[model samples]
Target: ATTATGGTVPLTDALELAQQGLPWLMVFDHAGVPLHLGRTKRLATPAQRLALIAALRGCSRPGCDAPASLCAVHHVRDWNTHGDTDIENLTLACDRCHAMVHDGPGGWKTVTLDQDSQFPGRTGWIAPPHIDPTATPRVNHRHHTSELLATTLARIHEQRNQEREQRQRWLSSHTRHTHAA
Candidate 1:
């Protein structure tokens, strides 16, 4: 088996080395704490780890659909500011969401989903408003006459359908060849 550092050794070789009964030393972190070869405790308790996993099961950012495996663990409270390693201060977010959280100019607007308040009101995943609404009534597009626009949209939709059919046929032929092989 290969160790995390990329060094490989045979299992029999390792067992023989262990059987020799040489004095072994195990170190934890940069601390001088020592332990026997087979003795080690996890950094986080089982409950704490499970809580982290639960938080990651859904995207931490509002309205995101990315799953746990595609997300990263984030600290609600800054870790450098002496935040505890408890589950309450941890969250999981996708890379895009995480970047948005730390962005400045077009940054994310974070809010707790607690019972007290609801963020984003009706639209859960929209950019923040920057301009005031105009006092004048909005123009209705249906009243406008634009035959060219309708024809263009229809042609685009037809082309998309044809491309989809071609992709499906390619996939079917590839599957048949794989089964024959």
Candidate 2:
């Protein structure tokens, strides 16, 4: 497909080009090391890249349901600080979550399973500033409750009713004005 830049390139063509002529070998002379193609020049085997992409196809956050294509690949540890460009250290985060990670006043924090007893076998990752440091983090069950779902449905119904009432009032006023004219 052609990009906005008007350059047309097929995936097959790009892959064929990448495979041709030992590209990594050519680039190694400039940097004195085998360079990884995608994330930050750190050496990554093809298998690792594929795994990372698969992991990113779903939302990086533990409970978030956002699709991977809607998210950005984030460095769990900042890349510039000598963080390894490995799948284990990378995550896919939605834009809001990604921004919360980097720009929050206290910075982002991740709780490994070993660190927290409550979230055993799962890494608890939290976006900063919104997270309360002093309070123990707990999963919000209310967000998943049937009552909450019903409440949301009721609110939507109420809004539609208000809109219908407003429309009826407008039509009545217009009709009266037409009759008078």
Candidate 2 global lDDT: 0.51
Pairing residues by index, what is the TM-score of model 2?
A: 0.39
Q: Count steric clashes of candidate 2.
A: 0
Clashing pairs in 1: none
lDDT of 2 by residue, 1-181 (tens): 2221224478566556657853331221221222444444545555443443332334456556555456666666677876566655665566876765554476665433343464342224654545665534332221123435666899999999999999999999999999999
CA lDDT scores, all candidates in order: 0.47, 0.51
lDDT of 1 by residue, 1-181 (tens): 2222224469677556656873332322211122223424454644443344332344555456666566667665557767566655666666887776543555454332343332111112223334212211111112112334665788999999999999999999999999999
Best by TM-score: 2
* Consecutive 10-residue window with the lowest summed lDDT within model 2: 25-34
User: Which lDDT value does model 2 have at 81?
Assistant: 71
Off by over 4 Å in 2: 1-49, 103-106, 111-123, 135-181
